[model samples]
Target: MTDLARDGTHPGAPPPGVTMSAPDVDTHCPYCALQCGMTLRATPQRVEVRSRQFPTNRGGLCQKGWTAAELLDHPDRLTTPLVRDPHTAQLRPATWDEALDRVARTITGLQTAYGPDSIAVFGGGGLTNEKAYALGKFARVTLRTRNIDYNGRFCMSSAAAAGNRAFGIDRGLPFPLADLAGADTLLLVGANVAETMPPLVRYLVEQKARGGNLIVIDPRVTATARQATLHLQPMPGTDLAVANALLHIAVTEGWVDKDYVETRTAGFDAVRRSVAGYWPAQVERLSGVPVADLETAARALGTAGTAIILTARGAEQHAKGVDTVTAFINLALALGLPGRPGSGYGCLTGQGNGQGGREHGQKADQLPGYRRIDDPAARAHVAGVWGVHPDDLPGPGLSAYELLDSIGSPTGPRALLVFGSNPVVSAPRAGRIQRRLGDLDLLVVADFVLSETAAMADVVLPTAQWAEEDGTMTNLEGRVLRRRALRPPPAGVRTDLSVIAELARRLVGDGMAGNGTTGGRTTGSATDGSGTTGGGAGSSFPEDPRLVFDELRRASAGGIADYAGVTWDRIDAEDGVFWPCPAEDRPGTPRLFAETFPTPDGRARFLPVEHRPAAEEVCPEYPLYLTTGRVLAQYQSGAQTRRIGPLRTAAPNAFLELHPDLASRLGVADGDEVTVHSRRGEMRAPARLSDTIRADTVFAPFHWGGAARANSLTNDALDPTSKMPEFKVCAVRVERA
Candidate 1:
């Protein structure tokens, strides 16, 4: 955290006419994985934010970062807790005490009536690392329920799975973002960073100015694609085929780095055989991309001195997403990109803390430090840190979408607690998810604003905003950055860490018997009792994020994404620190895989993958493909961005983006209402005719709710490996509404 001045003055000086009572707090943006650095200063009337020098943004601020301060005091901010009156069955404002009591009582009653697994906890990727760690501990230590997971499962699971499969690790970006500026060739598959992260465009601009080849593969000529030297528009869900074709071309053209492949990688022969069948012409016929374009893209990547390949949500939200990403990794390996100084394959994580959020225990199958829940050694190490027996911890749970789908099932959780996420607006098959939430015996949601999910909660707890709390967030580059609070939270608003701690203490004190002990050792090393407690809960659940983080460092000491060497003071002093820092005296690793991979054999693996059709393919009944993504003005689900005046004004509602030819064929003009139908459900939005999109594909922003909810038309087919739902590609039909 940034230090505050004792005297009444700003960091350097107060603005010309404004007098400050304290120093401005230097912090990172509350949205996106870039985590742009900024300084928050207080004036007499309003708070102001200015860009700060940072590794990712380089002192550049996107529109979202410039206008983020407006959301601090939003009119719709939830100031106090709300509890549903059982008789009236309507939400009514209640004191924090009453709300907490009701929540604990309900959780206890539900567990006693059903089973310990009847209660579940749902977390979010936007949560700080400390909060995420604490919530995961609360579920395992207090509730002893295996039904815990977070929203990041929807964002980065497929990429993480593929990265781990091929490299024995997944850190989002193995290299820093600044490396993009120096690349000789950069290939972006299904990533539209231009709109989602405008500040990052400067690096692309730098690469272009240097005469580097910039290639983009997508179904639409998006803002980012328009900037590329070559754009290969493939049909949705065919990214794997495109990657395999590029590899096939590289092999046919004799562009493979045979020496590097022989020394630094394994299983290349299998991958080479797999790509042998994906001939350029055959792939051109399978996907919509042409043969010439495929050959051109392959040559650029193959011949470049330093090349990078990246995948994003567009390529990783299908039932075949893991295979698609693995295909890309196979190509990168064949090109000898991994473990190079400045070139590699990477994933563009979407949420603010998606990389860090998954590193901690909030993930369904993971423990802190990215440890597998089913691993005995990992369970023993984490349990020792929590002062519990390894046998006391529960096993793995369902993935995000599967957990939501099982909400009303006979064997699934009957009660749920949500923190920092509004799943109703974000989950695939959202309409059915909404009905599932309604079917839950208890639904508790925590947020600063009344989001679509919180609006229907049986209990709503107000949480502190980003600038009103102090914690840490790990950016896409695996750099740990501090989030400093400029001011205290509102009188009734609390932090999620505090809420989880208090709830765990309450459950422990009341002896939710079927579970393990919680209260005594909630904080790291608060008690000396090493093994599992017999029957009583401790009262030592700490609410301080710093204490929780201290515990996290110890829990993650020897694990994969180790944070033992990182400290708050070090982060502030060094700007930010990268992890797997095992000791405080050693500098953290900024660039990974320079010498060797982390696998047992010390070599990157080449996983042979084959392309498959999307789970829901377009047929005669639904003859068009539907895809969803973010808009420039709205962040994911628009839980916070929707409430900001400027952001909402820029993108007020969802729109149906289709090719001009498709609009003309449907007899619909721009601004005319159109209905999109799929096997799951339908959504209505205004037509946004443009020649940028392919004639066979339609696009929609997934940031809106109500009749314009795009996720309603998405498929819920899960990827067998990653458990990621098919949110990007689905079969649909369009009509004038």
Candidate 2:
């Protein structure tokens, strides 16, 4: 493990106005996807944070990063493990042994009575790389259950699935973050990084500095749009129309890159002919973007020296999300941006560990190193890495929503273990998911705080937060960095790794016994001690985190990641390095796609596109459209950031965004509480009038929950390919309270 700060204290520790010495600690922001590199200072009592050198943020940080210390010892922080008495809803402080034993007994009881499939594990993208890796292994090897998934199903699973299908691999940026600094044009669809990851806005700012044009397409004009050169307000669920229009212009006007198309793409003719009917006027009628603006956007994209098209959940969180992303990728291919410098298709991942979680196969249908669970070769590879025979591995598992819906059903998984996720506040169809959780036989939740999800658990395991843990985290651009602990873990709290180990020991027993999955286990499972189940009778297993990374390096043997030469020694001496580090002498790859595609034929696929209406459409009774997104101060579901002082002060509560005309018609004022309803459920929050929203549209932050959860009204209908919910836009009605 890396050493603690020389001064012996946590970073961001000073009082609101006090000055302190910088602790010789370097780390990344523990909050959002921007992953701004920071220098943390610590004294005996407090920690202070300042911006440091990093490619993504480049010596810049948002308010959340600056106030990291507020959460270290917050009032609501859970300092001890707790267990709820089944008879009464009271939570009593319990020892770690009691909590772990309770979880073990409950899980064992469920498995014994209902079968191994009855138990499930749910992880989160907010977890550190180490924690995520451990959690995934713990589920598959110790629990021996295929019903493992995470909240990423609600975030970027759609984008990841689309990218893998089109590009043959799933790298969010196949390029570096700095590449955007030189682009002459940028087309952003459904992203509001300005409010979510403020440090990243600098790249757009730099683009504007060089006369680069900004084209923003969204149903609502967001904070990022205020700086845009052009904003194309589209109708809900109609982004495919605008995307097809751009492709049509590129094909008809002869702007298509014939060389790249012929050399590196398949299914071009089909896509070309498909877009012929999507003319500007037709697209304008379908989307709300005017014909003139569509033409201008197409021209700007086609004619710019270098154009980058970036997309996020807003475009990917729909029933037709996969098709929409495929269409956008086709447009990028037609514009010849994927393989060139200063131009490419990039996705800004929403969570701090979203990219890494996917890379390590924390999803329902994937394996480590982004290998498919069903593919023979991928299964062989992961099984070999996991020390299990390919045939011994289970088949593809259900997505998060499906898993939640399946609970307590005859065909459903009945037990669940959650780590660092609050689905009651974050998942779509919150009411249904909560009821489903109630139907489960057993529920164990591990988190730093008593999150909404944990509130329903039969046993709650208190775990360390970012400041109280030591691990690595991968940012949006796939940059891996170390997250060192500055403070000791709370009195009765434990690291997720320790808790997972304790549970694994309880389930699998001592290394002396042989289990087919874990080989001859010394501690964890056989799969190289990284908690993977091997082919042999479960043998030797290592419980240490560093050894786990060693096995991960071994598993990525011939691939882009080789960590044989890397050690905590080297990491501490030289700071953190990017992955795909083939050798000790060579530096890690910062950008991908410089040479060739990773596909079998070395060509990218131009997946066909078709538009589908949202699962729920606005009716006369509910005539206004509702969109969900992040607010400036709150992170996903507000588990930790909500406790941060400065951020909480800035946005203490959730408020609905409405157009003045709509608000006036509804007889609602700025502070008036209004109930927003859909077929699924409803929530009441104060309404704020803003001209930025369309007259018939309203907006709300997805972070609000509990009695006022946003997901209660969100449609849980998922994209057919990715199984991601439509959290972006849906039909809803608003009324004055």
Candidate 3:
């Protein structure tokens, strides 16, 4: 197949540049994982975005991507450092010198009093690969602390955990998105790509045009589901049963790929027995999907020449998320989908860099290149690149929620450094997390905007925005593309790398020598005995993106997501490059496990999983299941997207979406005020009545904070294997306000 056909870029003629003289800089959008390619024409006044043909989103731009430039000149953008007054409890402008010195002193004092682990670092998946790497390195080497994790643990941790257990690696999408176009059938579970990533719906449209069938399993008839050939609306948190029942039908009808299963997989007997109990009738009773529809969906998958199974947060943000994904995988294995062209299972990553964030040491239990932190060999390899002894490196620390939960505890970290995430509006039980932030001795937030989380920080550092920075971001398809700086950042703002380096110098002294060595001590020769670069006690960390990427390459040499062969120059020349490119001249592996699986015996494992009830079940008191998701106009947390005038106008605030029956029962109208109360907290929003959702379920977007924060009612119950909170399903009572 041609590259254009295989990569899923433009299927027609390319468009001309908006400005031919200046040659607009080609870059990807700063929104979802599709990272839709776009060209920016920069002028003294503003930047204009135009679609650029690329693999993921082709030449289309979503509403968020089209309005992303508004954030560059947002009125509330943080242009200088701010330090909160101890007595007044109000943040006031402060000089960089004053803010840095005070933050350093507070962190040092905290470490001295409560030990190294007392200082924690929290990062975000929106950060570039280089920033994520630098943040992890700064946490482990400079602070010498084990308390470090990123927001990705809340995004797709369950999918990652399940993928690793089943495939020996997790790269979001093993095959290119283009492969979906050739599949005979597609079974999408809990993903509303038509609304979340609008450009991707073209593939589904194409599939339908070609007479291919589409099966969508979700609690709500989402926009994406409206286009499906068969939409199976299951009860919330019953996805595992739907998947198990499908496999049961396939096995009972003698539609299994017996030869492929025996030759390419192991542990099938256990899975077969596990799924035998989930017959169509039983699944229909538990999942609320009719037996006729379940049979039709199963037959479509079982008989298709090639099919694809894709899932997203809806099926993964539950107490049994790993098992839910595992059940889906078991169905794919039974049908011999994986390792086949135009077929296999993949997770649709939500965040822009969610696929790369966890692969590069930002996760609590991981190192760069998807290596486990507890593995001795992995530690030695990463430590050697960082110029530190393996023994000096800290072991696995707390996961994202665990770290957040420990913020104000007696034995918790006394200080926290947050970069790029607004957890105040995004975290499960957000109201509690906000209160926890209030109790911290020191909270430092580095972001371009004064987000809800930054507003509560003791010190807020102004950082460079996406268009003003040069780095690389890995999209959902495992393709790493370069993001070039089109213009200079605001005068007072600094890049995240610069902020991280400055903090490292102040906290660890001469260890700022970008070589990654700490020298096992914290002392320097500058003011307050802390060294400055250029003329002080030690060398400075390289602020250049290329230099930092060189170190990242070295650190990831032998790991699963190896990028040693990929470089900025190569990315610029080739549009993008896929990972596991271990050698300079070697072509990247586009579709993995074509010949053999990555497991020990070169065979895929069929994990046995069973359906489980939601962690927080609906009862008489709170007799409705509440699920949370995103809206088309707003992105995560609404930190940046809300600042855009048109987007804000499009989606002003959060609302409760319920079936007409439920709305009638509650005596609420479309625009009537309603109060939703859960065990943890209550939130109020306008009720939006619809028949697309199950009568026993309600829906809300989790993008807004304050009284509209959906996460305030989300459960923090952890998935045993993934540690992912149950953000998709919770119990709540709705009343007219």
Highest TM-score model number: 1
Candidate 3 C-alpha lDDT tens digits along 1-737: 01212122232322222232244888888999999988888777778777777887777766677777778988898899999998998999998989988888887777767878888899999999998988887777777788999899999999998988888889888999999888899999999987788788878888988899999988988878888999999999999999999999999998889998999999999999988999899888898999999999999999999999999999999989999998998899899998899999999999999988888888899889888999999987776566566676789999999999998888898889999899999999989988888888999999988899999999999999989999999999899988878787998899999988787777657332222344333222212111211112112356888888877887788789999899998898887889989977998888987988878888888999988799999999999999999887789999998888867876888999999988888889899999999998989999999899999999999999889889999999999999999999999999999
Evaluated at residue 656, the lDDT of candidate 2 is: 91
TM-score of each: 0.95, 0.93, 0.94
For each candidate in the order shown, give its overall lDDT on alpha carbons.
0.87, 0.76, 0.85
Candidate 1 achieves a global lDDT of 0.87
Model 1 misplaced stretches (Cα beyond 4 Å): 1-23, 513-540
Report the Cα lDDT for residue 536, model 2.
Answer: 36
Give the clash count for model 1: 2
Report how far off residue 597 is in candidate 1 (Å): 0.9
Best-to-worst order by TM-score is: 1, 3, 2
Q: Which 10-residue window in model 3 sums to the lowest lDDT?
A: 528-537
Candidate 1 lDDT over residue span 241-320, tens digit each: 99999999999999999999999999999989999999988998999899999999999999999999999999999899
**Segments in model 3 whose C-alpha atoms lie over 4 Å from true places:** 1-23, 510-540
TM-score of 1: 0.95
